[model samples]
Target: MDFPKLNLPPVALRTRMGDRGRTMVWDVLRRRYVTLTAEEWVRQHFVHYLLEACGYPAGLLANEMAVEVGGVRRRCDTVLFAREAARPRLIVEYKAPQVPITQEVFNQIQSYNSVLKVDYLIVSNGLQHYCCRMDYAAQQVTFLRGIPRFEELI
Candidate 1:
């Protein structure tokens, strides 16, 4: 299998026998048999990385959740909520590895944030990841080299 260029390490993909005697691999979270799209592939790895490396609680991480903005429905790649508060804290926007990380990606996430009111935003294309903390009060964004660990956020 050809894997996309990612800054993170390769994930362990498992193969299973399909109904038609074809082989299929369980996707991230081992939830379903999905033909791995470039963005899904990156999201799978990143989800595990967040849980293990960053101490983000897997239970608090929501994937492909829908939110409304200006009466328009939009889906977010990933949203991390505070364990105790159950309030959204971080929003992640994922792109296919081949797709460039551009202002449009940020704008899309920002549009979603208008409703979710998350504190931090992350945009990634597997090969590169960008993180920023939103200063809503000041109407500014501060870029960070990486996302803060769960402990730091708490």
Candidate 2:
């Protein structure tokens, strides 16, 4: 598959042929090879950015995390956990490079937040990125100018 160049910094990825010659890319967080779709390509790149560029610990990052919402199980794209508290601090959702980030995407992440209650939420389509800090007490959402470093989140 021909993957488009993303806005994120490029990183080396381990890839291999899977069943029926499908391309599989190694997921560091999941520790397995997952099929490399357009969205997966963006996800892998962003996860690498989070680890190598943003100072987030690998142990504190999770991919395809299960969450319970409205009596249903859903998978969050990426979740960052608090080191000391062991609670979710941030959540990230990814889309294909061609997909535009919209309010529906925000609503989807917000629904997941209902269960995780993370302080930060991020939405990316590889080419564009957005970060929001949720102030539950004030019932306000603050759009961040850029993605914050791991230390800043704490």
User: For each candidate, what is the lDDT?
Assistant: 0.83, 0.95
Clashing pairs in 2: none
- lDDT per residue for candidate 1 within 1-154, as digits (tens), equals 4666588767686666777775566655436775566777788778877887898987888888889888888889999998779889999999988999999999999999988888899998888899999888899989987878988873
RMSD in angstroms, all models? 2.4, 0.7
lDDT of 2 by residue, 1-154 (tens): 8999999999899999999899999999999999999999999999999999999999999999999999999999999999988999999999999999999999999999999999999999999999999999999999999999988984
**TM-score attained by model 2:** 0.98
Q: Cα miss at 40, model 1 (Å)?
A: 0.6
| lDDT of candidate model 1 versus the reference | 0.83
Q: For residue 93, what is the lDDT in candidate 1?
A: 93
lDDT accuracy of residue 41 in candidate 1: 77
